[model samples]
Target: MPLSLLLSLLAPPLCLACGAAAQVHQPLCGRCRGGLRWLPPEQAGAGVPLWAAVSYEGPARALVRALKFRGAVALADAMAAQMAANAPPGLLESRALVPVPMHPARRRRRGFNQAKEIAAALGRRCGLPLADCLERPAGAARGSQVGLGREERLSALTGSVRFRRGAAVPLRALLVDDVVTTGATFAACAVALAHAGVRDVGGIAYARTPGR
Candidate 1:
């Protein structure tokens, strides 16, 4: 049998949320996908205008957890579709799609930067150039930010990221991430991109947690 089929037969793919049989390379089944609540864009504080596809709840939250923690990388394609669907008008015209960078150590532990995967998928979907323009300091501290408030996240992430040297940064770029919580990471990325000479910065994420 083909490897994929063999694996599926041995360990049938199941939905991350409801344990239903999952489609090939997808974390959620059709019914679980239908449970992802769409969220409309609104003014999220300064720096860059942000757009998000779904609220960080229900099946959307489970999908993100699967991608982030369980190495269900294929879900990136699904998440990218949502990102593209919720993209702000004219954002598809951005010069490049830049993923929020993870510190090299953290990325090493995770074996992949989920944001980069999501950004690359989004770029393919939207036909925008993909760029790895930001680099988090290798020694930046690591911890769960789940309970931290907005200002706390900003304080923790302060001085944590900078533009990668010699990386091409376009005049207008869209920062991409799997989720947006406090917007601190996006704000920091905008500052880094601005320092590297990007004139305009906008952001897109698969999910957002309101009032975080």
Candidate 2:
């Protein structure tokens, strides 16, 4: 048997949010999943138009924390499912999914890029192609944007993100991220893609920080 299958038999998966037993394919228990506060169709107007699946509060917040900080990568699929379902009509169709790039040092320390993982799963569910064409060069300074304001973030991220040297730039691109707080990240990414010849750029995230 595969090692993953054997491990599952020995110790069943547990909910990342509440620690209750969960199915192998699911990261949250039914109750926690049901508790997510689904948001109405709303867009953050900071940079490019962006849609979110749920408010970044309660179970939704917990799930994002688990996936981003606790290494519970399995939750990406569940988060992506919600994003795919809640996406605006025609937003995902015919557009390449571009995961917001992470700084290399941060990605190495975290062992993965949560945005990329979420975007990968979202692509599979939405029938979109993954355009891993954006990147943050190693020369750029890396800092936490946790407490920064929108303008502050934009200033700090300026010139830090760029399109890869020779990757195929899609005609239309939809930026993907695990969370959208002030939309600075999406804006920065959209700018990079636009400079690289992508005509249309939009964004989607699993959760959006409430009140931003």
**The candidate that achieves the highest lDDT relative to the unseen native structure:** 2
**What is the lDDT, from 0 to 100, of the residue 168 in candidate 2?**
96
Q: Give all TM-scores, in the order shown.
A: 0.89, 0.92
Candidate 2: tens digits of C-alpha lDDT, residues 74-164: 6798888887777778887999999999999989999999999998998899889999999999999787888888889898888999999
lDDT of 1 by residue, 1-212 (tens): 75656887789798889998987777789998888888766657445788888889989999899899988777899899877777667777856999999989888899999999999998888888899989888777668888887788888887788888888769899888998887889998898888889998988888888554
- Give the lDDT of residue 146 in candidate 1: 82
Question: Which candidate number would show the highest TM-score if scored against the true structure?
Answer: 2
Overlapping backbone residue pairs in candidate 2 total: 0
How high is the lDDT of residue 173 in model 1? 90
Q: What Cα-based lDDT does every candidate model obtain?
A: 0.84, 0.87
Superposition TM-score, candidate 2 onto the true structure: 0.92
Worst 10 residues of 2 by lDDT: 38-47
